[model samples]
Target chain A: AQRVTQPEKLLSVFKGAPVELKCNYSYSGSPELFWYVQYSRQRLQLLLRHISRESIKGFTADLNKGETSFHLKKPFAQEEDSAMYYCALKGGTSGSRLTFGEGTQLTVNP
Target chain B: EPEVTQTPSHQVTQMGQEVILRCVPISNHLYFYWYRQILGQKVEFLVSFYNNEISEKSEIFDDQFSVERPDGSNFTLKIRSTKLEDSAMYFCASSVGQGGGYGYTFGSGTRLTVV
Candidate 1:
């Protein structure tokens, strides 16, 4: 079965502190991994995809196949970073449907 | 920017009542999907629609659930008989899906409350 796991349900960080949200996946074949973010009263939007290897809003996530992980990282957390983060997987043996993790609620303190 | 829009930002209905959630996908998107997130739970995939037909669905999308693109741009998900467990925030998503690695655009989502 295809599954995405985000062990931490909530992560609290202070401004200027580094933030790292862990995400892991289980799938028989290679799957495209993504990080999505939802800010207060905002729609869910894609943050970054592993294949793109590009950073968005100062956030980056690298897909580690051997570890089956795609942990999102940011050098500095800002008050604006407070939101819900979800790790999602799509395509592969699982097909085109997306499978999402339990998501981590990120709270950046002022 | 073009966005996927869901109507009736929130809905309240009694259990066993049939309800329909509506969505207008990005104009150029070819793939559409429905997902629900119950409070305090993981977001779960319900179904995917393409070419005016269901291309894929998860176990959660059983007989009670159905998706239709009744018109050119609007996509709809219908629950024949909603249960208490059906109360959730339903998100509608659309993807250009021309090739691999394309991301989706999600709607603001409709929060359904089953009484």
Candidate 2:
């Protein structure tokens, strides 16, 4: 079974401090990882996909094949960044479905 | 930006009552999916539809649950008998294909409360 694990259920960071949300996945092969964020009352939106290797809203995640991890990081957290962050894995041969982790509630304090 | 729209943002029903959650995926999307999340829990995939048929479903998707794309654009999920444990936020998602690059776009979700 393919599964995603987010060790931290909640994280608190100061407005200007660096933020890191740890995510680890269990897979038999190379996996396509993604970071999705949900604001207080918004839909779960795609923050970034590992394939693109791009940053979104100052957050970037690197896919580590050996470690089977993709951690979301931000250099300077913002108040608006306070949201529920989910780490997902796209597995199976077709890779259509996404298996999500428990999610980390990031709170950026002023 | 194109968006996946869901109806009845919140619903409350009694146990054993039937409930239907509606959604309208993006116009050009070819694949549709239903997912639910219990309060304080991770999102769980229920089923995926493509070409007007179910392509995949999870163990949680039992006989009581059914999905239909009745009018080509409108997708619906029906629960034969609602249970108290059924209270959760149900999200509808769509995608172009079964590929990781084209990640699914999710709707705002319908929060269902079965008492």
Candidate 3:
């Protein structure tokens, strides 16, 4: 079975401080990783995907195959960065379903 | 930006009652999905539909659940008999391609409350 793990349920950081949200996955085959964010009273939206290798809203996540991790990182956290972040994994081939993590609720204090 | 739209922002029903949630996917998208999040839990995939039929479904989607695209513009999820544990926020999403490589557009969600 495929599973995604986000160890931290809640994370708090100060504005301008560096923040990191860790994500790990267990899948036998090649997997595609993605980060999704849900702000309060808003729908979940895509923050970034490992395949694009692009940064969104100053956040970047590198998929570490050796460690089986995809941790999202940002050099400077802003108040608006606070939200619920989820890690998701999709099988590299033949599947459209996504396995999601429990999610981390981030709080950025100004 | 195009978006998936779900109706009945909130619904409260008694246990064992049936309920149907509605969704309208982006006009050009080819794949549609239904997901649910229980209070303080992770979002779980329920099913995926394409070409007017179900393409994939998770174990959580048991016999009590069913999906249909009655027309070109709408997709619907029916829960034959809702239990108290079935209360959750149901979200609808659509993607232009398979595996969500192009990113999925999600609707605001319908909050279902089974009493």
Q: Give lDDT per model, in order.
A: 0.93, 0.94, 0.93
DockQ of each: 0.76, 0.72, 0.69
Which ranges of candidate 3 are over 4 A from the true structure? none
Q: Candidate order by DockQ, highest to lowest?
A: 1, 2, 3
Say which prediction, candidate 2 or candidate 3, comes out ahead on lDDT: 2
Error of 2 at A49 (Å): 0.4
Pairs that collide in candidate 2 are none
Interface RMSD of each: 1.4, 1.4, 1.6
Q: Of models 2 and 3, which has the larger DockQ?
A: 2
Candidate 3 has a DockQ of: 0.69
> What is the C-alpha lDDT profile of model 2 across B16-37, one tens digit per residue?
9999999999999999999999
Best-fitting candidate, measured by lDDT? 2
* TM-scores of the candidates in the order shown: 0.97, 0.97, 0.97
Candidate 2 local Cα displacement, residue A100, angstroms: 0.5
Which residue runs of candidate 2 sit more than 4 Å off their true CA positions? none
For residues A25-92, could you state the per-residue lDDT of candidate 1 as single tens digits? Answer: 99878889999999987889999999889989899999999999999999999999999999999857
List model 3 lDDT by residue over B4-96, tens digit each: 889999999999999999999999999999999999889999999999889999989999999999889899999999999999999999888
TM-score of chain A of each: 0.97, 0.97, 0.97
